[model samples]
Target: MVTYLLDIMEYADSDQVIEVLGGAVSTRVIRHPNRSFAFEVTLDLEKGSEHFSTKPPLHFHANQDEFIQATEGKIGLELEGTEYILLPGQDEYCIESWANHRSYPLELERQEGRTVVKFLLSGAKSPEVYELNTLFFENWYKYQEHVVRKGGKIDLIQALSTFDAGGTYVSFPRWVPFGRQVSQLIGIVVGRWLGGLLGYQPFYREWSTDWQLACDKMESSIFQRRWAVRSKPD
Candidate 1:
């Protein structure tokens, strides 16, 4: 969260390093079918984040659940329709499957003159779960970063493809009744079916560190991958 500038990155072992202006994300993913032993995210927020979103879009996972524990800064967790302020070691928090949620930074808590934010992710998985991997974190953030760095807004079709691949669904406006469920169905049609027909891919090699893993998972699904979707795109 704090700071860096330049589009360069380095990946070693399971940790993928993402550096941006005044921010850095080094992701480490430990995988398993029933649980993810570790998915650590460090958000350093000082300045220079004008192009990025302060919080993720309101979204829910169809089969994945997450736990959050902050060790450095305050995290504002918006869950369902309420926002909860989470402090370091405050308590163990869990975001269940299909729970609409997003996270944002709160006031700086340490003396680093910036928010020293660190988080650990543990997931609840099952045989029915389609996506237990945490590539969603890297893929989503990296895609947004890529778009912003190019001085453009996110492409909706591309976003839909990523969400579908990650087993996530966007939430609709609060005024609409059953908006989340409605939006979920719509996302499947627009982002999954229609988008697939157009050859928009859910995982992109330029944006995904674990591209093959993501591709393999998505390929096992109902939609057949076109050659473009199956191979690395230039």
Candidate 2:
């Protein structure tokens, strides 16, 4: 299985991309096939280091509070620079528009790896996110290293523009005709690679299972359901 580092700079504002405090985090946003809604979550992997940084001045969702949890591994909540170790199975909350809060992995040597997911509820859909994501990744394959340095940062500014205005459903345009199909396949391919590299034997085998479940739950507009699970990060 291949694990792509969550290069949010590909689809988000680079300056807005917060480094997950303590673990390797991969974030993916899956949009609903028939609606203006989208579900985004980050899978936090256990790391050798104990420090991470948050993107300050987060104002993405002024109307909603984000629901977050450490589904797997160890993490310490960083609220305005103070650290609070969050036990496995514990849940946390944050208001993105209000508090400048973020999380990092705990510093303990014996702490197990962890996975954290965030449910963002927003009505504004950014059409440029789809455009830039498709274009950036497409160019990435052809130009590879050159694309990253040359024009990668442009994607985020465009995404922010599409999402700048407030609305009930963030309107991300479905520019690629086969977007749903492609995203599913990417999920499967990425999941498999990640599992193999991280030794999630059983977990790797179930990547498709989790992707399907996440897709199904997305249809119902419920991001918190147990069925909407992603792979467990080690």
Candidate 3:
């Protein structure tokens, strides 16, 4: 594997775009030199054709807290045991630390055009949250192509294991008996040993050429988009 020296100062652009769940996601650092304080991420999705209604797995951030604002369209969020639908221009929905939450688009069939929503994340231990996000997306992006072509599935155990290393725990769905404990144990073992053997690095390595390539791709796309918007007729 080739390695490249990456500048820490330029890790992510304030307007960098990255691919996620077959959608375009743009992330910006809200706080200054210290990103641990807070950061913002926005997802843009097309109506009808894009499947944005599927919710993420039920999970909790042990340290980080998140607030979501919908700029356009509506978003559904499950915080703790209650559900909420945030409309455009409404107040931000806050999810405190340790609260189990899941987010998804609301009423996709009724929505038209495009949808955009932003998330502001912050907490005392927010750095770990950011690291976990980076690791999860890196692994997902790396294997997305292969998984699609082979009609294969993502290894949930492996993903849980990798996230465990960054202090994010994946809770088992209620259907499985004693799944929480069992999955935790398996995650710890695989994350430490098997994941290492397979060369899964949970943390960002600036020296990895893969990291450099991913950053370059995102930045280039953002630059091109900005140039196009500027050159368009008013």
Candidate 4:
């Protein structure tokens, strides 16, 4: 018997990534619940050519699975008590909640010339997911501030709207790799026109009561709004 899996990224409407705080740590998510058990597949693409580029630090998904595949360039994977350097066409698979690990570029050559794609398979949504999002956004602001303090130009409008989509609610945005500039803009315009025809099936909603309260508080906060407003003239 044979089984087939789809490279769903090809059919996606958005790039499924966040570029502001986390740089190019972008992803596209697909959720499958009608199957035996709920699972999530996220394709993370990272470019090594940019300044201040780095992958997430060492950590593990509490109740999630992960599979790392090197499609265009080489990547390093540490799993099951060992580290492996994966080249193009190679993949490293790991069971969810079984190991603690992370990946990083091994050299400047690979850092500047390689593109690595990591696939994260989760059995179900995990708390670390939200934690990671918060960290990325917070740290990204720090990074932006650092850059500005150092006399680098920063986009305030773009920075304040980091993961926002101009509404009371927000979800993952359609993402496209930086290399695919035209395609990215076109995808966003097309998706807006077609109502997310190629959007992901499984979405992690951030409308929890706490999320709502946080959003409300943020909206009402004078300081936060001032910062966001100040960020807009960039």
Candidate 5:
């Protein structure tokens, strides 16, 4: 792990391209503070292929709050258990902490070539696991795209692990009482404990920005920090 960390550190000096979903999505970070991080995401799916899902399953942030607004075109958003289409002029949707939400591409917006949306993230919880910032999104989106481009599946354990790394927990059916708690427990055990036993990690050098950056950020938790490879300072 230390050798791999050293190998990837050579590339960390340069900025990584923020594209994902087989190049269907691009992102840029505008603000990067832990409490008020901001960024723009552009989704440009292929013509007549809006069915392709470029988003993750509905999940809830245990410690983060998300806000989204369409700046250029329309985007499909499912928030607070209600699915809706958000136009450019629509009001910013504040996804409170623990709210169930997901975002995906839209067909109607493809006519304009691309849909640009801005997102604001604030650390809503104590951030004891991981903070919601550009680094978290970097590994999260890149890993998803890596799996898609490989035309293969990354086991459920790996997926859950990444969700945990980003402070996102799988949201169980809302109808079930105490579903959120159940989901979090499943993620920590299956994604963190079992996945770690199987040598799976929440962050990978192949899909993330820098080895040390992740190592530094994940120090908030022992489980999260252990998977990030590190070396002694020279």
Candidate 6:
């Protein structure tokens, strides 16, 4: 399959936005060509509100490095069990390959306003890394809806397992017996087959050319109200 990565240091004219965590926030793929660099932009819908109340599952890449730049508002990051708060204009935080990490907003108090961040993923496996996330966000809600129809909660394991074939492995708690091996097996055997049947494609075909149209659509969406309001200072 062909892949594309976005150019570093280039401004994105438009971006394909996808909602996550129930429309609380959205992520846009800024650039992804068929090379080593990839870029993404994230916007928080509710200023000052937590992007996600709970910590995300721990995961790491074996050959990709991530750099995060806070464009607006502050962000909190946890890298290798250490916490750091980053304010706008601060230096970018680097997460080297194989470093266990996660990030969220630092303050969840009042409507301090929204935050915007730019993330750059690069290195030997960057294209695959970007594709893995693209696949998940693109089909996450569909997977959830499917489970809801069956009177079952979202099957995160099954949904996330789709990335196993591409090397994006999820880290389970150490206490879960054979968790890693079992999950990998399920992702490879069950997730791959099921995802194919469900029509889940890993890469976005129009991201490079249709990004401007996507950006326009997202700006006019209901979520854009938050952006408008946040533009005015408190």
> Model 5, which residues run further than 4 Å from truth?
1-17, 32-36, 47-55, 109-126, 217-226, 231-234
Tell how far residue 86 is off in model 5, in angstroms.
1.7
The residue-by-residue lDDT of candidate 1 on 1-234, one tens digit each, is 421111112224755455544465554564434464345567656553443236678888787687776666667789988998776646558899889898776655432465457665666664542564556666677777787678798889788877876677888777999887787777678877788788776766676666677666666655535523546665
RMSD of 2: 17.5
What's the true lDDT of residue 61 in model 2? 34
Score candidate 3 by lDDT.
0.50
- Candidate 4 root-mean-square deviation in Å: 15.5
1-234: candidate 5 lDDT, tens digit per residue: 111111212222243448766556677555332344555566555632442544558988887677676666667788877888766655666777788888775664453665334332233335454556666777777776677667787679988877876778978887989988899888888887787777777777665556676777556556566766675343
Best by lDDT: 1
Q: Report the alpha-carbon TM-score of model 6 versus the true structure.
A: 0.57
Expressed as tens digits, the lDDT of each residue in 30-73 for candidate 6 is: 55343243445454535314425556566655445656656566
Q: Predictions ranked by TM-score, top down?
A: 1, 5, 3, 6, 4, 2
TM-score of each: 0.79, 0.32, 0.60, 0.40, 0.77, 0.57
TM-score head-to-head 3 vs 6, winner: 3
Cα lDDT of model 3 by residue, 1-234, tens digit: 211111122444443344444554554534334333344556666522333445667776555565566655667788765888766656656677656677776654544654565554333335342233443444544454346547787666456544654445565666778655665566556764465455444433431224443333223332212211222222
- Mark the regions of model 1 whose C-alpha exceeds 4 Å error after superposition: 1-14, 18-22, 30-34, 51-53, 107-114, 221-224, 227-234
Separately for all candidates shown, the number of backbone clashes (residues 3 or more apart, or on different chains) is 9, 17, 0, 8, 0, 10
RMSD of each: 6.5, 17.5, 12.5, 15.5, 8.7, 12.2
| Poorest 10 consecutive residues by lDDT, candidate 6 | 225-234
C-alpha local distance difference test of each model: 0.65, 0.33, 0.50, 0.36, 0.65, 0.48
Q: How far does residue 44 in candidate 1 sit from its true spot (Å)?
A: 1.8
Stretches of candidate 6 off by over 4 Å are: 1-8, 20-23, 32-40, 45-51, 110-137, 140-152, 173-234
Give the candidate number with the greatest TM-score: 1
